[model samples]
Target chain A: MADEPRKIAFICSKGNLDMAYPALIMGWAALGNGVDVTIFFTFWGLDLINKARVDHLEIPPVANTSMKMSMMGIPGNLGIPNIMGVLPGMTAFATALMKKKMNELGVPPVREYIQMLADAGAKLYACKMTVDMMGLKKEDFLDGVQDIVTASDFIDMTEGAQIIFI
Target chain B: MPTRTYAGKTVEVNEEGFMLNPADWTKEIAVEIAKEEGIETLTEAHWKVIDFCRQAGLASGKAPTLRTITTGAGVPTKELFTLFPKGPAKKVARIAGLGKPEGCV
Candidate 1:
């Protein structure tokens, strides 16, 4: 091991079901490499730490241009038309399909990932400005959240660390 | 690939020192690898994780990820960290004579 452990910090600003996994997966991998991990959740990303919203996150297909028919097990290079994405229950369908695929690969749910990261010593923080803007209290966040911190505080805390903004 | 001696037995290992062949593993080799990872003593708890990882890794042809070890081996994530500090998944795999776990979680 190096004299000082490598440090990587992720700034999560989105909260879609698909968007949430990138930081979690990368952070877990970093931990396996003995790197220090810190994650800051701001804006819509605060939903990840919110007790009421974390598990119930939905992946809205609308405006998600990358969504393809192949993701739904259809054989084609065709993309799902944004027109169809606006239909009722499309978000639910998309979220369910993604969750099923993840489960089949033995991937844990979002809440479990958060718990696992916490147990493995990753530092999780909710953005204080977002929390205040949304009128959320500390109790509204998950158990793993260390604290609600300002953007400046997060910058100071992650000095000299590789930063990934998502 | 590189070969290193552990417990007087030469075995193939990767550049990072993880065993390339799970069949070449032994209890003595595990103890020696544990020492190299800064764990001087292998407690019963440590052996439980090691045994589970070895069996699971051999059965699956790949080492188990941290989540698999916790759920499949019935070890708590935090306890696994205490049993094998720094990086439990990688450290346990190295000591258990298994390939490095390839999963992200």
Candidate 2:
């Protein structure tokens, strides 16, 4: 147990409501185990750090084969049909259902999770190329973001650390 | 399933040194365990967190996670890191004579 503390770096490339949690949950767990955690948000993943979108992330059911009715405690193994998912309010409905389940399980929302991770000292970085391409400034991100760094810089920073791309 | 002496009282502990039976814990045992964890002194702050963990663990049937500790015990996350160092959730569980916290944050 006295050996060097392990380090883990998570590359977040997706920004859906469901996609945002894997890194946050895993990073929090790693920090609890005394592992150093670093997260890099690139492309759509940058929306997780965008203050405007962080709290509004939605889970569209169109391509989500796992969005089954059983998740809502319905008595069937039926998945939400892609045709039904294309309705005007389907995305909102699905997002709300997921949020309800997460709340029932005592899971923190994405914004709060980011705050918790930052307070616990996990390093958060935004991908610079994405930031520039999206015309986003540092102020567009949440306070937890440490900096906007290039992908090469991220590699150099996480040298010898276990990397997980999600 | 190993027995060890803490403050001269025999208690069962796991391989990771977490007390197997929380009923066998006492303030003296906590002190000795804290020493082994390199915490020479169990400050008032430490005891507050420990007391919360024990009660919460009993109610939940599992050790409290770091988020539970901070929100339920009224200790901030930064302060918990400072108080228990390295791994606060794991260390606090071991010293409080509770099982390790589940890994799903």
Which pairs of residues collide in model 2?
none
DockQ of each two-chain model? 0.75, 0.79
Tens-place lDDT digits, model 2, residues B53-94? 999988987899998899899999889988988777789999
The true-versus-predicted C-alpha distance at residue A78 of model 1, in Å, is 1.4
- Residue runs of model 1 more than 4 Å from their true location after superposition: none
Task: State fnat for each of the candidate structures.
Answer: 0.64, 0.70
What is the Å distance of residue B51 in model 1 from its true position? 0.3
The model with the greatest DockQ is 2
* Candidate 2 residue spans exceeding 4 A from truth: none
What's candidate 1's DockQ score?
0.75
| Interface RMSD values, listed in order for every candidate | 1.1, 1.0
- lDDT (tens digit, per residue) of candidate 1 on B20-104: 9899999999999999999999999999888989889989999999888889889998898888878787898999999889777
* Standalone chain B TM-score for every prediction: 0.96, 0.96
TM-score of the B chain in model 2?
Answer: 0.96
